[model samples]
Structure formats: C-alpha cells, structure tokens
Target: MDTRSLVQYELFGLWLLKRMALRFRCFAKDERCRGSSVIGLVCSWIETDLEGYRFGDNLIVGSMLDDLAPDTEDHQSRYTSSALDAVNAASIMLDFLKTRDVSLIKEIADLARDSVDMLAQEMISDDLTEAALENAIENHPLMVEELSLQEYLWSLAGEVAGSGDFFGDLIRANAEVEARLMK
Candidate 1:
C-alpha cells in the first residue's frame, strides 16, 4: 500500500489497540456492570474464557450487535464490525503480552507480513529502546502508565526483542482477519 494508506492503517490500529487495552483495564478495575457497554461486556466475556480457544471474532461481534448493545437503536451506525474485530484482536494481544515474551510477537508478525513492510517487521523483532518505549507510552495512556519507564521499555523490548514491526504487524493482521471475515 502507499504511504498515506499505510499511515492511516497504523494510526487506526494503534488507536484500536489503545482503546481495547483501556477498556480491559477499566473492566479489570470493576467487573460488576457487564451491561454498561458493549465493549466492556465483550472484554469481560473474553477475559473469562480460554486465551485463544474462546469465542471467534465474528461470533463475539455478532453477539455485540445482537445482544450486548445497551439500547435498541441501530448499533451498526455507531460501530463497524471490522473495528470490533480489531478490539477482539487487541484483547488477545493483551493476553499474550501478559506473558512478557516478546518472541511471541514473531507469531503475530509472521501472520501479517504481507500487510507490513520489511523495515517494520525488522523493527518488531529488534530490541526496544527508551525512545521507542516513550513513544508508546505517550501514545498509549492507561495501557502503559502503570509500568515504570524501565519496566515498560524492557517489557516491550523483551517481549518483541526490539524489532519495530510488532504493532504494525498486529494492525495488518487485524485487517487481514477482518477481510477474511468479510468474505
């Protein structure tokens, strides 16, 4: 894809991941009101199930539209299925990230290599630096705010081994999955 499309893809992916992460954190803080929001309910459901064996993205998204919506209005107007799928992917990513193994990123990167560039793929596999970590921290609020600078930096570096394509690959993978679901 061209640079503009690539940038938009990356930006959207980052935003979705951050939003999902924030939602998960919010649910973790209080798991009581599952009916409060569709995203919150989905997060709760996913967290309680097996890591990767639980509900499929399509299933969860369908449920979100059919059952989880807090109201009866046209919910599709407020959310896209693709975006919901990304949220599901981000939740899975959060689960994987809990392991603190950056090598795990390779599996995700490999899955979406076609959508990402070699340079970003290489970065995803490289070591994480304070600069990069700071950038992530700035871009992602509650997601990493709980970690000390060093902890956050090492977490992503050690998890992804410093390569830079981690998030990019994730975004691409999300798009790929959404496309497949569309078909």
Candidate 2:
C-alpha cells in the first residue's frame, strides 16, 4: 500500500476504535437503560457519520484481509500483530470494568501507558495516548461530565459496579434495533 493509503487506514482504524471505546464507556455508566437497540443505534450513528469521512474505508481492513494473497505470510503476520494489540487493549479495559477495582483500573491504565510510552507509538501520533484514553475510559465526556451522574443512577437502581444493567440494556436495545432494520 502507498503511504497515503497507509495513513488513511490508520486514521480510520483509530476512529473506529475511539468510537467503540466511547460507546463502551457510556454503556458502563448507564447500564440500566442499555440494550441491543440502543447500542445498535449508537453504532449505526457512528457508521453513518463516518461513512464519507476521510478515512472511512480504512475501517474495512478486517474484511479486506481475507481477500489478500494467502501465501503472504509476512503481511498476514503484521495484520495479526496489530489486531492482537487492539484486542489486548480492549481486553484489559473490559477486565477492569468487570473487576471495578480502582487498583485494577489503574493497572489497566498502566498497560495503556506502556503501550503509548514510546515516542513512535501510534497513540501519540494519533493524539490518543494513555492519559487521554484513561480520561475517556473513566469519564466519557459526551455522556455526562460528573461521575456522580453514574453513581447516582446506580444508587437509585440499587446496584453496584454500574456496568451490568447499563451495558445489558444497551446491547439488547442495539440488537433489537438491528433486527428490525434487517427485517
């Protein structure tokens, strides 16, 4: 791929990842109303809004990979490596949510820190470094400004962790909407 294409691809990937992370954070805070339909709607919005954006096609790399030459082991390996890194970052975040331990969250933050420690880290170039990522993870600016909003909602609902209900509602709402759209 040419340099322009590579740049486009990276930008698109970053956009998608950032969207996913934001949605995840929102779901974490508002578990009570989360459902597949809600999540689907949010995702649909992302796709639609980003459709004609500069790096939109870069978001299609996973689909394109399978069509690449099967014998191109090096190419496949590099793709796999990058994919794994993304997966690892996401996994660490998920684990932190599941545990809800401040220490664990801090640790996960550290992983992100480590990932972006290098001057050449894409997070740095993309302006999505660990500090920004942690801020996004802990507090989704688009959703609400105060952590108290989440805490209050959870308290009213008499729940701890504030994750299960919110994310469950979002996933279910998203699925419902997707199903209807497909019909």
* Predicted structure with the largest TM-score when compared to the true one: 2
Off by over 4 Å in 2: 1-83, 118-183
Top candidate (lDDT): 1
Query: What is the Å distance of residue 36 in model 1 from its true position?
Result: 11
Measured against the true structure, the TM-scores of the candidates, in listed sequence, are: 0.23, 0.24
lDDT, residue 54, model 2 = 29
Tens digit of per-residue lDDT, candidate 2, span 1-183: 343332232222222333333433333344332222333333343344323332223223333322321232333232233332333433433332233333433343333333233212323235678787555544443223223432332233222123355445434533543453233
Worst 10 residues of 2 by lDDT: 153-162
Which digits, one per residue and each the tens of the lDDT, describe model 1 over residues 35-117?
A: 33555454444334322344444445445444432231433221222233334544444444244343433333322221122
Write down the lDDT of every candidate, Cα atoms only. Answer: 0.37, 0.34
Q: Against the true structure, candidate 1 has what lDDT?
A: 0.37
